[model samples]
Target chain A: MNQTDAFHRRIDEALHNAQLRQNFRSALTGIMARRAEQFPDETQLQALRDQARAVRANALVRQPELLERLEAKLTENGIQVHWAEGPDEANAIIHGILERAGAKTVVKGKSMVSEETGLNHYLEHHGIEVIESDLGEYIIQLAEEPPSHIVAPAIHKNRREVAELFQRFHPEIPYTEDIDQLTQSARVVLRDRFANADAGISGVNFAVAETGTLCLVENEGNGRLSTTAPRVHVAITGIEKVVERLSDVPPLLEILTKSATGQPITTYFNMISRPRQPGELDGPEAVHLVLLDNGRSRIRVDDELLDTLRCIRCGACINHCPVYVQLGGHAYGTVYPGPIGIALEPQRIGIHKVGTLTSACTLCGACGEVCPVRIPLPKLINRLRAEAVDGLRAGTAVRGHGSMRKPAEAGVWLLWRWLYTAPSRYRLFTRLATRLRWMTPPWLGAWTRYRCAPRPAQRTLHELAREEGFRNE
Target chain B: MSDSRERILARLRANRPIEVPTPTVYAKPLGWDREHCIASFMQRMQAVRGEVHRIARDAWVDWLAGELPARGIHHLLAGNGDVGDRLASALPASIRLSRYDHPIEQWKPALFNDIDAAITHARAGLAESGSIVLWPDANEPRLMSLAPPIHIALLDSHKLHENFAAMIAAEHWANGMPTNALLISGPSKTADIEQTLAYGIHGPKQLITLLLD
Candidate 1:
């Protein structure tokens, strides 16, 4: 089996656990509900989202200049900035930094970029101790599983299971079913790591080109501890996070929270401008930013897929997605999940590797509607479907439409081309298909698993109108 | 490396000069009127599984008591110490009423596991989107607003902002503002598993906002 198949099998097996389902269900509902409660009116939130989209668009248009500005300003402000063309380069940069620091212990905040680069595993393989600071992240870390959800990493695990895991992993610590007790236990354990860690790693939510600053927002204070407590702090981020100006921040922040956790704002929005200036209370002595291109520069130039770069990793699209509900994030087989993941994974990685993620969306446009930056996700996915089909066909016309050509040759392509080319012909075929609906072919049931495929509205709308005595003019 | 650094530095200096855009030529009004905004906000709130009430200020305490038993909330962690003190006296002693004033380290875990509901005053209510802004202060631990099963926020009718821009401005202006501010609309929820609707996952199961008029 390929990487995609293996990832699917792992998550599929986990989904059977009733406890994980219950936990995921409750968590998703609360997050969706909270987000709605936070931004109750769609129109109001949409406006904020549009404004944010405009800002992101502006940043993308001037990314080369903005990135250069950010590097200089961040460097001047006492940050060592490194430019990485891809994941390997990013990992190498981080590895080099850690090696020079002689850092044996590292604590990590929740960063999707780190996941993208597979940093923790890389560091651990090299004999460096890495501990996830976020409670949800820590839970998944113990489970030896990748995060299923972005914001709430371990949304798949129940409290009882968490207690059991904690008991087994840390035998000295007592098992407590209480969520708060569990959080406290994790906190106590993680705090020790934070206090003693030689280096801290973080993912930036937004980087300001104007101020050459990095913004870290988190509900838990772990982000603060990760950035401040360690002797050295290194941020791994994609180039897409750069915004044009510091003044443009509030509008983006306004929508990010509402769209993310339905919070008007996150618990903490910490801005690190310069490394701890003299008389500063607490902050890292040295700050470094690894500006990772990682295929985003290519994505930025692709007009069809570029809007995806505007995403703040809010996971709003996932919350509203129907497909994500059934399979979960791990099923997407990539770091980014849900609707955004479907569009992003193919670009960040190779399309063939994440080809299944592209087919996961329902095309309901819920993701596009909910997106703060107005990314036309559904449209982009549709465009990708066409691209994928074209690539599969490879320009050679197949047999089928002309029976005289060759009956034994490839049929799926010829069928698709014929069906898609003529709307009237396809409508007639669908009308005939309605008649054959009662047949209930074995394979057809699997096709209709998620859909009823209602019997073509019985008679046409024209027929119903005619029966109602309206003349067809 | 030196040459690359110099090249980068020169580029940064060239772009360091800020280019301010022309003022928004057409700042369209948010596509909602006052009543419509409130109605839409409430609708979205209900959609996300939050219980919203439009109530009079004088009737607040009685209504709070009435909703709790009906909603099966027996314990509450309230941020307003004075209000919590009053609530303790008003309710039967059998029902636990804990005032939230502990340090973040202590309160975070307590709020997560112990409290049935967490109630705090909202700094601003966005009419356009049924959202409340709660800034973490000395008395209120940031986690208390999130970690619990049910979140109850009191929004003074006067605090309603027409839109989010106004909400941000008001937040910057709120005196003694803590470093962390949260704009919470509903409870913590996700549909990561089979799109099933489950309540009270990582955060609150129920989100209740009392729009005090």
Candidate 2:
């Protein structure tokens, strides 16, 4: 099946599944309420968000210069920085580093960049063992499923499912449904991996240009262990993560944590500037940073879409999104799902490939209002929708999902527009519809699939007004 | 790779958006006094399930001596720094202490499996977020606080700052940064499984702060 058809089927399945809907509804509601409670002082939060927006905007404008400066500073600090034009190059660079280190087993912290590159699959295909150390990532890795949510990868799964998964994968350990017991089992299993792994891989949250520091935030200590336990550490990030100064981090960090999980701060916030210094007790001896472009450079130039790059991946937009709440992330059928995903996936992959995803928004503006950096998510999604329509009409193959326009649908829209443009035709059509209201056809299946078809108003509002005016005369 | 780098950089440069100045709205201090800052730090730390003990500068050793045994910390890891050395010396003879003088590369399995707790000095504390900044170096390694089951951070009250941004700007952190700097708020935790909170997944489960006045 094509991408659009598959996307539709996923949505259909998700909508039909009552359990999935309930899970997302409860999870999103709690997250949204907690986020609301955290920011009691709305005025101060708005002011801070404005500042964050400007910071991201300014950094994006000087992205190239700041990137070069970051590279130079990181090089001086003894970090090997590699630039990749796309995911292929990124994987190759990381694989080469692991190969040089003779790393047989590798532990990974939760990194969306790695997911974007499909790094785990690539490495496993090459016969390298990669273990996800984060609790959520580990669960999904065990289930052999992609992450359903950005911050909480396995938010869809309840404790019972996890217990069963653990029991299946770890036959040696006795099965238990307790959350704490499950966590302990994972720790016991991953601890050995951390101790024996030859290399570690992590994603960079914010890369400070002036000091060449890669700041990573996490609640689990897995990130710290992933970077520190092994001899070789490889950090991958998008080119847009670089900030001009170390000082730029505070505001970003403040909003990122609060917006993400309503936490005042994550447990561990690490700033890695270099590899292990001489005489140092522990840390990676060789640290390599791979900066992946992967179509971000193209996004940097688009005027309407440039702000999409300013996202910090906090998942607030995901939680607050109405469509996302109803359908869940799996329905989007993209690595990055939700409001940000609808706007971004099309650009990163192509507009035509994710055509169904582009239409997966109510444009309620909830995501924009809750965004820490105040990215206009609804506006960007609208632009993608417009691009998809234009691409279809022009017979041009758009990037990502490709063109998904039907000539019949276009003709129907054109006929409706022609009738609506003239008052006489519009009135005649309304009158005819009112006369044969119950004759609505079943072929208009998309509209009436989940909802009742609306009959034309008994009389157009314009007709009622005119009749009222004549009676007054 | 160089060609890729140049091409990427050139694309970014060509497509750079209209520049705007970075806002200074968040640069102001949080207006917390010394006592208030300490209180806030303690409150914030406790909220995240971290233990905070405020003691006189001379009373830390006595407090640790009593608390360590009570908490069943048998084997404690200490760095080679003066503060670590002093604290380790002050511990009772009954308590076994190990100084982290060698690189962890030499004994990865033993260090992770054997150590009950690790002691390290925090450079500063942020009152707004209740975080202790640790700039671990050759003397005190990064894993001193991470690998063990329990992490005890010794912090001086005088070093407490209002928030992270103010601390960074005032400390001139942009000039020079250590290989690894950390801002630890509490013990390692996760709510990943159905949003159920659990502590000590891969890092320390307990974070105890010795706030010295």
Candidate 3:
């Protein structure tokens, strides 16, 4: 159960599976291509990105005021709000709401927040049968697997694999390899559950402080159904999702859809201002908004760490990450994966727990380039890597800042620094390494396991320059 | 709950960064007139697999009457509005009519299984994205636009906006919000199956725009 062991085991298994590698490769390649096509005008895309970054930054700067305004507006509009500092409290609040409504079964739309809190498992432990309405989510649920990709949770599985999984669970329904048939099969099953479920839960894409509205963006209508068809609806989100104004929504929404799925707009953009009004024919009679802190408020306090919250959960960074393309989501052994995970997990779980993840980055800068909100993910990952060794920030804030600082590793780095700082020692070391090159082993530790061993150059660059009759200016 | 809320807000207030002013919303305008909006809306809608039919204002019911039976639709759900009421009175008995007149609990099973299609009114249309904005209320309800297999939206040309930002500013949505406001661009779809496009995964299978002048 140790973080390092779990991550290493999952990573080893993932790298050895050729099929999983192909699945991530094909899916990410297609997503990257479509994302490029959507943003054909470079100048316009940059303008939109800047606008989005400013809106998010403004919201974060004024978060406390905006959240108070949001709670007041939502209360005025007839929505009950609750707060939780961690996952346990969040899950408990949701469970209490469902219990008050006397709900036994629940239908859920796609929610990464719910996953972060492990809501499904929590509810099921309390005797609630939860059905996932989103197709990708439903598929993964049937397989009893965590989501592999944020946007496409079931993207790691092929059509044949989905068909097999569906048949294993719902044998009464005929099986077919056709994607349409497979999709329709999920539709038929989840629709039945949606119709009968007593309560619904969903995630918030953007909660507008100006209008006290919770906006949900989705291509499938399941988000609408999950929030509408049931007697009670519970919407949970991180506190950072709130925006300052209604007009702020347009550009953010525009960038989110294009960056997330390369769509002009999704099939449904559902905004809920309140529960059903007096004598309304449909919609949840009671709506609850649970604002989860879960270390985000602490994350907000640090200026450098706060930029990680600017992520819209678009998954563009994930789609464009070369490391993620090779390893996939499951290999990270966390709720979130890819560049965002490497940067965020170490902070949320503490540097001591998952700090090793920071070293996985190639720092190719693709994730930063495609990030709609300009999160500077590579820079943040590099920051985490340093934080693991000896963070400049207070250890009480991030926890275990210098835990990865092993004496051996520290000694090696210190010796290297000592030698490199002086011209005489550097010259002697280079001379000894070049002369001893024939005795160098073909394999090093984990570094040379997947790579060739490094050997010193036959002559230092300074020696070559001297031989060529050139002098330092 | 109160304790947690207070502490969370306190932490946020204490650690909040330097204030940055909200930037002006930057949405590219189509810079086109009504005819251009219609053409652009149609082209974009069609590109996303939406069916756009330019019908005369009074001929929508007649067109619906002819089209429902041709598609073998036996039961249809409509709202309690002008067009919905008109369809109820005019359609033949062969095509059964269902209204979202009562709370969904009254006929949850029928609404989920029996209805063949649903028709709702559009408050506005975005020309750039080929999307219809629906303000669902007591009479129409949210599921009327989402639950069924087919979504037939009646859009008026006079209600067209250049884009989403234009619609928000013109309508003064910042002043007030609805129970549910929706922007539907096309039918339900997903590429989750190894990135293969499949329609009608959990929502409507088709999105038909009855554009009226």
Candidate 4:
């Protein structure tokens, strides 16, 4: 099947699965409620949003400069930094570091960027064992599934499913469907891996340019153990994660946790300035930071589209998105899912790749409204829709911009343009539509498949006006 | 610089976005009096299942001696400092207090398996978020706040700041920062399982803050 067919099949499967739909509904309802609670005052919310948007905008505008400053500071702090132009290069760089360190076992914190690089598969293929330490990540890893949500990776699995997963994976432990017991099993299982792992990998929440510090946010202490317990700590992040100063971190951090999981702050906000210094008792002895630039700089070049880089990966847009609530993240079949996913995936992989994702939006404007950084998600998705067919304005077109444009569709649009622009053609067309209302088809396309297409009225508005003795004509 | 770094930097520079003004600082000192800040801090902390005690600074050791046994905590892992020594001298013989003096490599198994709880010193606390900040050093390792199933943190009342940004400015973190700094709000938790709030998944399951007044 083609990409579009595959996407539709996934959506169909998700919609038909009552379990998945109910899971998403309950999860999102709780998230939306807690998020609202966190931001009780609209005035404060707007002010924080403005502050966060400004901070991200400032970072994007000066991205190149801030990145350089960050590199310099990290180097000064004794962190070894590497840059990768794409996923393969990034994986190779990480592998090379592991090879030098003789690291066979790796524990990872939840990092979306690592998923973008397909890091786990790459390492496993090279005979390395990489364990995901986050409880949600651990659950999904055991099930051999991709994360179904950004903040809550295994949000698709209810408690019974999780207990079953634990029993299936760790058969030695007695089976229990209790939530606390299920969590305890994962803790016991991953704790050993963390304690003995040769290296730890995590994603950066924000890279502070002013202090050369890498900040990671997590409610689970897995992030801390993954970064600290292992002898070598490797952090991988996209180039856009940098902020200009120390002060910029607070507003961004504050909004991120609240937006992502509706927590005032995650349980742990870790700031790593460097590897374990010479005198420090424990931390990673060697710290390596890899900056991946997989088509981000290209996206940043477009003035209006540059807003895509403003995301803090809060997953708030996903929670509020109406279309997303119907189908979980897996239905999108991309690394990112939901408002940000549809908007961003097509950009990373050419529009020809996932451009069909643009069809999966209602544009109800909820995602844009809830975005803490004020990213115009609807506008960007709408732009992508146009870009998918007609292509963006002149030289600014995205990859495979006109690939989805069909000759039949284009012809219909052209005819529509012709008929709508001319007064005589429009009047004639409307007269025919009104007189032939009985002939209107019950089905036109997939849109009409769910609901009846509107049939023309018995008389045109002008005819009614003429009957009423009003004559603008 | 590596070739990839140079190339990536070149691409970013070539694709430089339009200039935007630097942001005006939005995080401000809450301006709450000490009493209000303390109350707010206690409330926020407790909301997330954290235990807090407003005890006099000198009396914290005695309070822990009384409280740790009540919780049935026996093996206490503590940093090799004033608090560790005090716990050693003051606590009854029933509770075994282990000092984190040697390198972690020497006792990884014990740290992961044997220790029941740990006590770490907090650099500051934030009332806005009910977070206790820790900057681990040679005396207090990074894992002190992370590894053990139960963690007890000691914070001075004066270190409570209105918010994270205010604390950063007051600490002048940009001047010099430790290898690892953390803001721990409560015990490690996860609601990933059907949105069920399960505490102490990977990090400390219980976080008790003995606020020194």
Candidate 5:
């Protein structure tokens, strides 16, 4: 879909649904409030952010070495490590694993990687019965929709609707409005499936290269069950999810939990090195780690764009984002959403295709402030805009921008072309745009919906300081 | 199979390039306070619908008995400790009491929802976030701290730490890198459906932490 069309359609539908808006508002408020009380001071959070970023940076810096060590260690521990270079290869490797296992039933934990690979649709097409064991995931699975929120998959749902949805599956059950009763019902149902599942699919929260251990964090015990109850446990993780060492984890955990859910630490943290050995009562007998490159190696080589890889998918940026709050996740038209999604989906799919996704941001810097790894999401969005502009000039026609040749549009295009073609023209355009602040028409106002163009200053700060003879001072 | 811990500690702790963490300075208005910090933490939990109370150490057992019947609680699967035993003794003769000493799968259902409530003693409480950290042991199979619908935790006031950093340091001292550690703030909650605040979506619906004097 065209990015603008996708954004408009999803946002319109989501806005009409009062319940989802309330869910998102309530969840974001709860997380923000708890985080505020927990830290009360911004300094601590910033420190945590720095440390977590460093941990990931260290891991990525030693990617080749760590990947080799991780594969070797995992294989020694009776776990198969498969390297997948792209989406097709990743999906094929996973499907091959299931086919060889002859897996009829698969219980899944909340794995964003699976969403990235569209694993469930692929597996189901192969005749495997896949059940999303996570309560939120299960709700969406029943509704036949994608997750609108990362942390809370069914954030777009309401209790009354969920109660009605439950009724479809179990008619005999009473129409209980109580949340506990509904959760209990889900627990009972998923527990039975977990006990009998032929294979369990999971996503890695963090993979420790030093020990070849994969960490799964959850508030509910379902993740543990998903990884342990089935004979085979399959983890689909992106190549960038790896951390260099175990010690690098504590600081990351501290930031991840607080940033994700305002918790000091999640309820259950399972670090699995290998499947259970002979005579062990629990844990999968066979373990497989699918290392998916899927555009990450290409992303890493781009120095300006590489910061997006530092994201932990904590959803902090989304929760804090004003635009995301109003539009919701579906508007992003991709697996990831919010500020990070704005930067990532464009890169993953195509910048020209997802141009509107990047343009829809407020540039409030809230996403950057809350980011655990400090990805500078707003800056990335701006860079994506520049890329989209370049892509359009390269004659790779996108849907909306391709057709937008109005006088104003053509004028802006011609201006950028001249600016790039001549530095003096660029300086003159910048000065002219700076002086024309009052002339921004309503259509331009739409482009600046979430942000002001910062009423362009009378003079550049550097130029003003130079004129004031304050260079030395 | 290699223990990931041994390898991690070896790599990060040995031949490590240590970058000292710079001191954090917050504005005076945001300076920390012990009581206010603790109360703020409790307020966060309360905002999510979890309850908090403070009682004299000697009155906890009696308090549990009085609160249990009002909530229609009967069967109890409690952590093994001096306080848990006292609470278990207060239950009616007809209400079954199971003392946890090891990981038992059959007891999960009873702990999760079949029972009225489960009471356990927490390792410590962090005042900064109003969070209670649980250390897994033979008597606490990790699930006991979570599976139950109603979690009634006992915390001696002395066990409370001023902040998360203090709590983390304390934990490192008590247990050498916990196999599993849980830092529970309040009850289980979600805002999944239509953004409505839903309590007890997965974890405990009601988390009652009684800070014992």
Candidate 6:
């Protein structure tokens, strides 16, 4: 199936799934309420958001220099830093590292960058086993599915589903739906993997330049285990995740956890400076960091769209988005989903491929309001819509796919514009519509499929205004 | 890779947004008194399901000796240093105390599975977040606090700071950073299964902080 058709099918499936909708509704409602309680002082939250925006803006302005400095400092601290222009290079670099280590098994923390690169598939194809250590990620991995949410990968699945999945995969362990027992099962399985894994991979939350530290924020201790247990550790992140000073991390981290999970801090905030230093008993013998650009440079160049890069991947916007709550993350059919995904996916993948993803938004601005970094998400979505329309009209490859716009819809819009521009024509059409209101069709395509169509009033508002002696002034 | 690096950097430089000076916005201190700060720390820690124990400076040894057996903590893993020596000397002969004196590579599976609890010292504490800062070095390996099911952290009251920003600024982390430093707020927990919170997924399920005054 074509991308547009597939998207619509996914949306249809999601809309019909009452259980999925209820799950997301409750989850998002709880998340939103907790976030509100976490930031009781609105003024302080806004001030901190403004400060975060400025920090991100400044970081982008000095991105190249900051990244270079980060590389030098990390190298000085005995870390091997590799730069990848895109996903292919990133996967190749990581695979090369694993090959040199002769790694058969690799443990991974929740790294969205790796997801974007399809690293698990890539490594598996090369005969290297990759295990996700995070409980959420591990559950999804066992089910052979993509994460439905950024933070909570298996949010769409209920405990019963997970119990069944664990039963299917872990036959040795008795089936139990108890959260603690389930968690213990995963821990027992993953602990063995961590002990035996030759290489570990994780995503960096923030890379501090001055201190040469790669910081990871996670509630689960899997992140620490992924980075520490194996002989070789590889950390991958977007080029945009670097900051100038270690001091910059605290404020970002403060807003990150509060906005993401409504916590003052995550359970574990690991600041890794280097591989096990001299005489250090534990930690990876070698630490490698891969900075993946993956079309972020294109985003960096666009003046209007550059603010989208300020996203911290906290999933706050996703939790607050009205369209997202209804449809869930899988409907978007992208690694990153929701308000941020609508704006970002087009840039990362060709706009033509996922251009229809922009239509998923109601443009409700809730995303922008809750965004800790204050990215104007609605404006970016509108921009993509406009670009898609223009691309359709011009048949241009430079813009994202215009395949979503049907010729019939375009013609109707053009006709509506023509009538609206001329008062006489518009009045004449309204009069005709009123006269022939009975002949109006019940089906107005998709719009009237689920709801009643409005009929023309007996008298036009203009005619009523004239009879009432009301002047235009 | 160098070519990719240069190309990526060049593109970034070419597309760099208009430069703005970095903002100087440190978080305001809570300014709570010592007692209030400790209380707040305990409250925050408990909120995340972490256990906090306030002990008089001189009573820690006696407290651990009495508590270990009652808590079913038999095989305790600790750092091979003064702290470990003190713990070993104080604990009763019934409890098995193993000192982490060698590289974890030598006995990875045994260290992670055999120990019931691991005790380590916190470099500092953050009152606002109720987190303990751990800078694991040769003396204290990282796994001691992570591998065991129960993690016992010893923290001094004087080391508590109001927030993360205050602690980072005061400590001058910019000058130097440890190879592996962590700010642990609670034990390993996950709310992944239908949003039901469960502890000890891959790390310590019980995080017991012994706050020394």
Candidate whose DockQ is highest: 3
Which ranges of candidate 3 are over 4 A from the true structure? A391-396, A431-442
Residue-level lDDT tens digits of model 5 in B23-57: 23211233556566567667755765658887887
Candidate 3 per-residue lDDT, tens place, A325-367, comes to 9999999888889999887888888877888788779999999
The candidate scoring highest on lDDT is: 4
Clashing pairs in 2: A349-A400, A350-A399, A350-A400, A351-A399, A352-A401, A352-A402, A353-A400, A353-A401, A353-A402, A354-A401
Real contacts recovered, all predictions: 0.01, 0.89, 0.92, 0.86, 0.16, 0.86
**Candidate no. 2 TM-score:** 0.96
TM-scores for all predictions: 0.67, 0.96, 0.97, 0.98, 0.71, 0.96
Of the pair 2 and 6, which is ahead by DockQ? 2
**Where does candidate 4 stray beyond 4 Å?**
A391-393, A466-473
In candidate 2, what are the lDDT values of residues A1-473, reduced to their tens digit?
A: 98778888998999999877876666666788788877999898998899888888888988999999999999999999999998888999899999989999999999998988999999998889999999999999999999989999998888888999999999999999999999999999999999999999999999999899999999999999999989999999999999888878888998999999999889999999999988787899999999999989988777668899999999999998888888888888888999999988888988767767877888899998999999999898887787776634443223642266667877888899999999789879988887787787755578887877776777767679888785424
lDDT of 5 by residue, A1-473 (tens): 65577777877887887866786676566666666555666787777777777777667656666777878777777789887766777788888888898889999989988898899998898899999988889999998988887887887676777888889987777776667688767766765686577899999988877667788877665676677657788999988888766666667776787888777666556667776654333356679998877666656655667688888889888888998887778867789988988888777766656667876787889989888888989898887776665524543212223332246666877877878798677677667766775665545465578765456666666567778888744
lDDT of 5 at A124: 91
TM-score of chain A of each: 0.86, 0.94, 0.96, 0.97, 0.86, 0.94
Off by over 4 Å in 2: A391-402, A422-443, A470-473
Which pairs in model 6 have colliding backbones?
A: A352-A400, A352-A401
DockQ, all models: 0.05, 0.81, 0.84, 0.83, 0.13, 0.79
How does each model score on lDDT? 0.69, 0.88, 0.89, 0.91, 0.71, 0.89
Docking model 5 quality class: incorrect
Between prediction 3 and prediction 6, the one with superior DockQ is 3
- Give the alpha carbon lDDT tens digit for every residue of A135-241 in model 1: 77887898899988776677777777778889999889887776656665665576457667888999999898866778887656567667766778899998889
